[model samples]
Target chain A: MDFKELDPILHSQLRLAVVSLLISVREAEFTFLKEKTNSTAGNLSVQINKLKDAGYIEVTKQFSKNYPQTICKITKKGIESFEDYVKALQSYMNPGGN
Target chain B: MQPVYCFINRLFKPKFQSMQSENFSPKDSLLLIDSMINQAKNRFTENGFLYLLWGWLIFISAVSHFILLKTRLLKHPEMIWMSCWVAIIFQIIYLVRKNKKEKVKTYSDGIIDNIWMCFGICMMVLIIIVSRNNLWIYMYPFTLMIYGIPTFLSGVTMQFTPLKIGGISCWALAILSTITLPIYYLLLLAAAVLIAWIIPGYLLRKKFKNQH
Candidate 1:
């Protein structure tokens, strides 16, 4: 098994997908990321918390029209991690698995 | 008659009335709050100063142009030309200063907005210079029409109604100036400023201010 240093929690396909989407989207609400990743609220919340704890993404809560809001944005550290992940993933996919 | 009756009855009948159900709930109230927060977060992430700069410059210039144009004293051809140059100098400085802080790739829309403002300023200078060449007096109104075209285009492109209104006002005044008194040019300038610049500027300022 060709493997490289990767965050165990983020190595999963779904979390990786979530991080990728967040990086490009500037900022996304919990609902939008849920729809985009096709993940349930419980699953996404757990993944987001993991990312937030890692300092890869920042989550802010606010009120809009008397309703609670949670917005997620990818951090600079997150962007760096994503780039590294892509490079590592690329190495794994190469013909010789270098 | 029976077939016609049957067709009419079929058309009037509500299809899928039984299938229609309110089983799904509306979007969560919490999501909207999150969205607004998200929107704010994104706005902050983007170049906030530059967006304000682009929005403010267009609006202020439009308003100032309208107000100054309305004054009978400013209608003096020499005064108009002098004021035009001063405004240009100020704008060139503003543009240079604003450019310093702006990162080219981060705010593309702001760059486009700045381009339009520059075009408007350049056209104003050209209009003033051409008016002095008595040889082009016959063509002066035409030049004015040309001047207004950029304003109109900028307005439409930016979705700022005032600029569009100003542009139309210029064309109308260009037509009106040919037969009417020179003082009428002043009046037309007033209309252009009011319609194209001042009102819209006020609206934008209010809009962004509320967002903060």
Candidate 2:
């Protein structure tokens, strides 16, 4: 049994989905992430904060069309962790390395 | 309820029905990442607009130039190139409008934008070279070759095959044009634009619509 431990921050369902979407685009509006992840605004906001606190993502607050806009972008560290997290999952999925 | 809030809720409501129904498994995480990445990579809507615009402009200009020369209908047939200047202005407007409408800037979008900007600069320099050195006879083939550089790279970035194929055809035609008489090179360029820009542009548009 040579299973690898997953990153605790990315192990949850909603958090994992948010990071998954962010990994692809590197940056996305908060609404885009919310829509893609299918998470409630409150829940998505909380997960985004967790990712930011972990230094895995950066959150930008700006104004667009006189409305407050929140944009979330993945940092270098986020990419590294996402890659490692995927690798860990891969090993777990195929422990025999086949 | 506010209209904006209602709109947001309507947009998000459908997604809620299908989510969080399963446990947070590592396999699910892997699947999510794969799907999300594919979604990001397949954007083609804006590409179509750019390709079709430039393609038609160049194609019409080149074909008409060839015709005017062949018929000897105009004393200043070279003036047809002014259309390209008009197209360039429209292209600027298109870019600025796109910039205003674009909300999220992807890494790939930024790279593609820079590639086209560099291509524009090269064309200006080529124009100067031709006007100053009187190398108009040799210019079309060289210009076609230059066009291929960005076209090929755009294909790679968009992961679109038609653009790559289009780019190759431009270079091949350029080589052929170099050996042939310069008079026939305008026709070759018209052919080049049809392949390198118009076809790929429409294909890009189709892909974009399908994705949306």
**Which model scores highest in lDDT?**
2
Over the full model, what C-alpha lDDT does candidate 2 score relative to the true structure?
0.80
B131-199 per-residue lDDT for model 2 (tens digits): 899988978998899999899999898788999999999999988985888899999999999999999
In model 2, how large is the Cα lDDT of residue B73? 99
Per residue, candidate 1 scores C-alpha lDDT tens digits across A8-98 of 4445445666676665555667776777567789978987998999999999886654767688888999988877766554443442564
**Which portions of model 2 miss their true places by more than 4 Å?**
A1-5, A90-98, B1-23
| TM-score of decoy 2 | 0.82
Pick the DockQ winner.
2
Interface RMSD of 2: 9.7
Prediction 1 TM-score vs. true: 0.41
| Structure candidate 2, residue pairs in collision | none
- Give the Å error, residue A58, model 2: 1.7
Ten contiguous residues with the weakest lDDT in model 1 chain B? B20-29
